[model samples]
Target: MKSKQENITIISIVIVRRFICFFGIAIIFVLNGYAQINELSIELEIVSISKGNYHPSPQELIKGDTFPKRIDFEFIVYNNSNKMLMIGSNTRCYYHSDGKETNYEEIGRFLMINGTDTIPLYTDRYYLHPNPHSSVKAIWGIIDSSKDFKACPIFTPFLKRWTNVGKDNTKELYNYLKSSRFVYVPILADYQRVLDKLNNKSIIDCIIYPRNTLEVKKKEPFSVFVGYLEEKDYDYIYPSEYK
Candidate 1:
């Protein structure tokens, strides 16, 4: 893992909440025994990263900019409804564990930064145009990945957008993806554990923040292989935060 950086800042949006109510949710579901999920999905994908304090771009860089150490990822939403799902104007991310709610001061935060120019990048925070309010506010937190949990994610995990199989939009959003039916929100790291000591090794956990959307009540065993980050050898596994 990389060393800890004293210079940290509170991000604008915090996305993590563990709410278990009563609903069964899964990344993949079948309708009438056919394999497919809902119209939209909030999925997670792994990315290999180097340890350092860096900014994704000159625009993203601020006073105390540092690459998130724990979790860094972007949430992509695919709309197969053949229609545009209106993006919302608000978002909230407050966490709770075992019935204990945290105060506003306990709200976690992370800097949203892209991994690479892997694809065209877009963020709801900066999406501006005819309707600035049209953007997906990625609200999430460390909720149990159990379907039995009353509150779980309803969206499924879609494959990489650039891939041909699930390739819904490789060239859909030419200029601003944030304004399109598909949205990408990058959740940088775990601010709650920001001050924790580094593992002092080149290998550290690389978690892609979330893999679903909407609060649900379901219990299904998920999260086993934890992905790891090391020198570009690309072999992987890190602590599975989803379960």
Candidate 2:
């Protein structure tokens, strides 16, 4: 015959052990699911590019010339299919020149905008390659050494040959940009939120303004995860601009 106090203590211990075991099992199941997700794969392509901001005339920065602080450009993306798609968070852009590929560090993230008529994803902006149309644009904001510019150059030759690179290059320029595809894995938390929005119908577009050129081609296919929209409705005004 056990006393009341002793019985209470024994019961408490049993409950505690059961809780610990249950928690451990839950953790294991979660890990196993995540591992399976990592094994999945997807394909992405740049469907369209619109005319953003074009300079009246290309500006040149001489040894003693002063350059503008920032430039703006507008580009649109087309998801290309009815299938609801997620931008591979791991994709990165790779820039190659001077017998090497440079690095393009990510400076911004993605945005989701539910417009009055359309749903569009506006990507995070980067400090590299702000204005791709600038002939004299410096690859990196800093021009300490010419080697730094190896990857940042606008690929003037490529652009000259393919006028539609900014419009319909996905089909015509796929071969040249084949290496353009790289790991586009989304950030962890973001990837989960995006994955939850399955079976959406809309165009997934990311607007990117890079500050560095050579670095763009040297990395994998990376774009800000501007969320998906209703394909039919896609317009959002920044809070500052909203009236």
Candidate 3:
């Protein structure tokens, strides 16, 4: 048997590796396959955005060693399903954007089509996410997964970060998002396990993005649901301004 110290060391190493997995492109290996039926359809939107080096420590709201030059964002995700969902305390969304742009190149990871341009996003909001991959707080059973279920909307706020954005051009990034009509996809997870009512086997993953399309249409004033994309928008073509 291993000594007490060795056991502790092994446990600590496992924890470190888990956090490191979320740090970069390593997240790609996680399989969030598309599951149809009573799974869940999420409606996501960006509430507010600000640029600075926001440190969570006392008196360091705008500058820190970890996020020295980053863009911070707030998102509201609604379950939008009739059935109750055990939302992972860490439910979050990552913006799927044009990777060729200098602004996005600096952060996140590549999602494979529209996701091809998606970068990983970290929000400073929602402190409930301790084990972002496997920790479910059992929160939001009242979650409005669908208006059909609950007429009113129920949501959770998740503030995330994208560090190393060119601070000077933060406004430019904002403008491009508006012009290009950026898209977002939810990264769902839970601590214990959420059953896939349709699949019979409990699964931690589900897929939503239309793999072939870019430019998920802006839903409502904030953005949610599937929308159309003109063919002109794809295949190296872009708005005249972007060209």
Best by TM-score: 3
- Which lDDT values do the candidates have, in the order given? 0.27, 0.30, 0.30
What's each prediction's clash count?
A: 27, 40, 21
lDDT of 2 by residue, 1-243 (tens): 999999999999999999999999999887755543333232232222212222334664222221111211222222333233223211123222343334333232222112221111222323232122322211111111111235554323333333331242223333433333222223445443343343432322321221111111221342211111223321222222222
Q: 23-54, model 3: which lDDT tens digit per residue?
A: 64444532322232223333223322322343
Cα deviation of 76 in candidate 2 (Å)?
18
Q: How does candidate 2 fare on TM-score?
A: 0.24
Range of the 10 consecutive residues with the lowest summed lDDT in candidate 1: 154-163
Q: What lDDT tens digits, residue by residue, belong to model 1 across residues 1-243?
A: 433442222221221122211122332232411221354444433222222234445665453332212222333333344332322211222211345434222212222222332221211222211222322334222212121123533211111122232222212311122222323332223322321333432322321122222212111221122223344442232223322
Candidate 1 has what TM-score? 0.22
What range of 10 consecutive residues in model 3 has the weakest lDDT sum? Answer: 140-149
TM-score of 3: 0.29
Candidate 1 residue-wise lDDT at 151 = 54
Candidate 2 deviant stretches above 4 angstroms: 42-47, 52-243
lDDT of 2 at 77: 22
